[model samples]
Target: MPKTKTERVTISLCPPVDLGGEPGWIPFDAPSLVGESLRFVSGEPDGNRFRARYYRDAEQHLHARIWFGPETEGPPGHAHGGAVAAVMDEALGLAAWAAGYPIVVGNLNVSFRNMLPLQKVVTVESRVISAEGRKVMVHGRIFSGETVYAEAECLCITIPGK
Candidate 1:
């Protein structure tokens, strides 16, 4: 006996979600500014590792719409702490770059608040809090609505003559 053909349904675990549409928000291209050095996190736009879109608000603060994919899982069904830290590392360092500071992250301090669920779209907001001589301080947080997942403070040191 021959088996009949059945329909195959393809469902995406990480579907495209809205970042935001508020006024004074402009799209930002990280690769255009810092080249391919950001390939670690924002490299794969559609890959299972991570998917992120960058933006800037009216105040020039850097914000990102990041999706935690299945590949970033650590806990049974949640994203790993290291994955969250990676997002902070990139986003905060990029925040300094976006603020017209050519620098590298010297120290990254990440504090995990809540475990992040995989395949969910979350927001990471960063701003250059202070800049004095060669040291630039940037703070950021990863959250979904009112639920905060992780927060980080990045200290960036300006490169000489660049």
Candidate 2:
């Protein structure tokens, strides 16, 4: 009998709070697509492959403590580029929302500086760079201490109604 190879992967994450002590880190509440608060990614019951807790720093920037789990792996032990982009998309878009713009991302540009390791915690920081007419520009980075993993710029457009 031959052993079967499995393509299915299981993801696991350590709580962000256990990684570091975040000051003034408050839970950000955003309307969920399912009419509840945002939960797992792609509606996966196990958990979000990349779990992020949003916050507002003392300087009023949109900040997030994110964990990349095994489910997000792209290369061996590194997280997939799409996973990083997804985190940036949500974080940058949320930045626009936190700035009082009811918005949806029009375009999202991401630059991968380095491969992010799986099962590690990183901080995602975002700021609304500018707002002109319906376009809102947001910049963000994913980093752990001094190492930068990725950076992103998101163009957001205001929704018709809140």
Candidate 2 deviant stretches above 4 angstroms: 1-21, 31-48
Q: What is the C-alpha lDDT of each candidate?
A: 0.91, 0.79
Q: List the RMSD of every prediction in angstroms.
A: 5.1, 4.3
TM-scores of the models, in the given order?
A: 0.88, 0.80
Judged by lDDT against the true structure, how good is candidate 2?
A: 0.79
Question: For model 2, what is the error of residue 6's alpha carbon versus the real structure, in angstroms, after optimal superposition?
Answer: 17
Clashing pairs in 2: none
> Ten residues in a row with the worst lDDT in model 2?
33-42
Query: Could you give candidate 1's per-residue lDDT for residues 97-121 as a string of tens digits?
Result: 9999999999999999999998898
After TM-score superposition, the amount by which residue 159's alpha carbon in candidate 1 deviates from its true location, in angstroms, is 0.7
Top lDDT model:
1
